[model samples]
Target: MRYTLRQIEYFIATAETGSITLASERVNISQPSISTAIAHLEQELDTQLFVRRHAQGLTLTPAGKALLVEAKRLVEHAQQLYEVASEANDKIRGQLTLGCMVTLAPMIMPELSHAFTSAFPSTKVMQVVGDHDTLLQKLASAEIDVAITYDLHVPEGFDFVPLASLPPHVLVGEIHPFARLSAVTVKDIASEPLLLLDLPISREYFLAIFMQEGLTPHIAARSPHQDILRTMVANGYGYTLANVRPRSDTAMDGRKVVRVRLAGDHRPMVIGLVSPKERRKSRLIELFENHCRNRISDAYIPGMVAPVMEKRIRLD
Candidate 1:
């Protein structure tokens, strides 16, 4: 059973997009070529990878799901070989699939992408944005070279390198009562309508702060969009608890918002890089990791205003 790297690439592309046509467009190959590669791959492995549905698209079979894990790893290793060869010649050149938390993507990706690309023009960085779970899944599945996200729940097989510690802060409309206060308590914010940034692990972390204070927030509005939550807070709909703050002090509608320190030992969000614990680190991944470690700091990020802490603190 000799399966070529090209076959694996076609399989992965089809599995991800769930359509040969889309996969063709993604890999810049013809539909027939992709279909033939998949067919040959299935025969070589003696397993039907995709179930074709009329008018809809392809769905991975259980066997397909299992094979995808290994296929991605193999393809990634092949790419890394190219990176290794380039590095051996004292050049940094290869492809990198970078995954970032959805909320962080809009604010950080542009700047990080620009810096990394400009520094290493030969390196190709592909960005994949998703929630924590999706990013973790991609990391585990070898779909992405590395992930930039909050150290929410980095499971057993991943290594997290902390970049910056972001302590929780309360955001309120400029006209809101809490805006006038220097610092606010969780209980105080909980008493008012709370606009939650409801994304998987992140949602739990925010709510847990209230739980620790023995208060149940008056749930008003919830959204997966950070901007929507901010806009809601700015519009006086409710107050939001967030670790990260935008550089701009205003919302999309031009209404101003205020960031008040959460008075107490609020758990800081550790923004970091996550990669597979056991995978051989490629030169490109190492270079990119170094770029992040050097650039991302406690007091500086491209689009976020560093939280004003009374003392330099990093909460474990």
Candidate 2:
């Protein structure tokens, strides 16, 4: 063979740590060994994977970026193959790559991860977080086994299993005029300045609330991070809308925010698991899928105080 998995491992380590010295430390290999492996890999591939800087570490070239994702998947799959071959029982034991929407990760990943890993102690879970489009893209590209996200803009070639439904609600600072209200309509929300979440599918979902009511938002501020948006709302910049509810009423900055339900018939977004429709499912994937369905009840989700509602959607 022109290259070995060891070389790929070394390449990945260097790319991740962004320095040969750190990669050596991370993998418990010598610095020269890491460098040699990288050189061999570059030669075999006939391309420069990284650009080395004098004391600034290494940065991935376009080629490196393209290979990193596939390399990680290959390495993990190889590890899973070994685990499966060596197993003497039916217990789940393998590497499982999971992707989650950025906003949902903090609210649900910890509990879901803990439950799944505890149920299958021999398994290793690799978690990736990004916006809806990014997670969906990874799932479509076979970069992740499954994804947890809202049922927004899901392409036709994917399977979705609804776990929970999160309804849209207005978020306001404690001192905002709407904070004390039990609920407000979309028209009320449209009348005020809006702080948009500004994520891929999520942004459209939020704006759709106003669209359904035949109104438009007066966007005052925007951010991709939910915490930053919450913090902005907490500081009274403007009100925002959201689906998932953290158990706490305070933002990351320790400022208080309130969730006021939309008074009218506002359609809620569906939170669920997504995977490619035609792909073969591993036993580990099936087990984790069932585990998610069984465990993601209202009582299980962290940072959620609202009653978990079941709104099923047939993806077939």
Steric collisions counted per model:
0, 1
User: What is each predicted model's overall lDDT from 0 to 1?
Assistant: 0.87, 0.83
Report the lDDT tens digits of candidate 2 across residue range 28-61. 7999999999999888889999998987889999
Expressed as tens digits, the lDDT of each residue in 1-316 for candidate 1 is 4877888888999999899998898778999999999999888888899899977899999999999888877876788688768968988887888999998888888899889999999887888889999999988867788999998798999999999889888899999998888888876777799998899999999999989989899988899999888888899898988887677899989999998889899788999999999988987889999999987887677687654332443221
Window of ten residues with lowest summed lDDT in model 1: 307-316
> Model 1 misses residue 7 by how many Å?
7.7
TM per candidate = 0.83, 0.81
- Return the top candidate by TM-score: 1
**Residue pairs in candidate 1 whose N, alpha carbon or C atoms collide under 3 angstroms:** none
What stretches of model 1 exceed 4 Å from their correct place?
1-11, 19-49, 54-56, 61-74, 308-316
Runs in model 2 lying further than 4 Å from the true structure: 1-37, 40-80, 86-88, 298-300, 308-316
lDDT of 1: 0.87
What's the distance in Å from true for residue 271, model 1?
A: 0.6
